[model samples]
Target: MAQEKEIHFTGYEKQISNWTDLIPAERFTLLVLQTLTEVSKDPRGTYITNDRLSNIIGLSPTRISSTITKLKKKGYITVQRVGATGRYIKTRDYNHATLYTYH
Candidate 1:
């Protein structure tokens, strides 16, 4: 029998809590987006799976899926499904968009 490896995450609690109030509607979606952003900032592009995301954020797949759909609908993120793999792309340029300003 093989011993299971333990994953340790330090300081992530604060990051997750900070996003609780900033997300538009669903916190899970925000969590996923924020995690993806952090990963993208790294020199190595990290490919995260839906199961890994759900486990890391302590949310169910159904919840994550629902949030993903909402974020996609709002154009905040892009999800590419190629066969069994799903890729998530966050629109970091949203700040430059004119939707936030009063017209």
Candidate 2:
């Protein structure tokens, strides 16, 4: 069997060095968010749902939601609501995922 390739995150030191105030969960979530942003290779952001984040981080959806809000409040990330058609817009015409841009 072929072994899966391991993935690594770059610039992690810069991400965590200045944020000594972060709790464990917040730090882990921020790292994951930064990794996702880099992997997506999009300047806009990474489009994701709370359920997906929960699965990846092994956190409850509610917990993940609150963590994300905390990150936003700390200016570590910016979130933009995406429409059903995958466009950023003012109106929430339907349920949609959010695009997370890591700072």
Cα lDDT listed for each candidate: 0.56, 0.66
Superposing every Cα of model 1 onto the true structure, what RMSD results? 11.2
Worst 10 residues of 2 by lDDT: 88-97
lDDT tens digits, residues 1-103, model 2? 9998644454563446456778888888887777677667556667777788899999998998899888778777777766763421111111232342235
Check candidate 2 and list the clashing pairs: none
After TM-score superposition, the amount by which residue 96's alpha carbon in candidate 1 deviates from its true location, in angstroms, is: 1.2
Global CA lDDT computed for model 1 = 0.56
lDDT of 1 by residue, 5-43 (tens): 644242233443444334634554554565666668643
> lDDT of candidate 2?
0.66
Positional deviation of residue 3's Cα in model 1 after best superposition, in angstroms: 50
Q: Over all chains combined, what TM-score does candidate 2 have?
A: 0.67
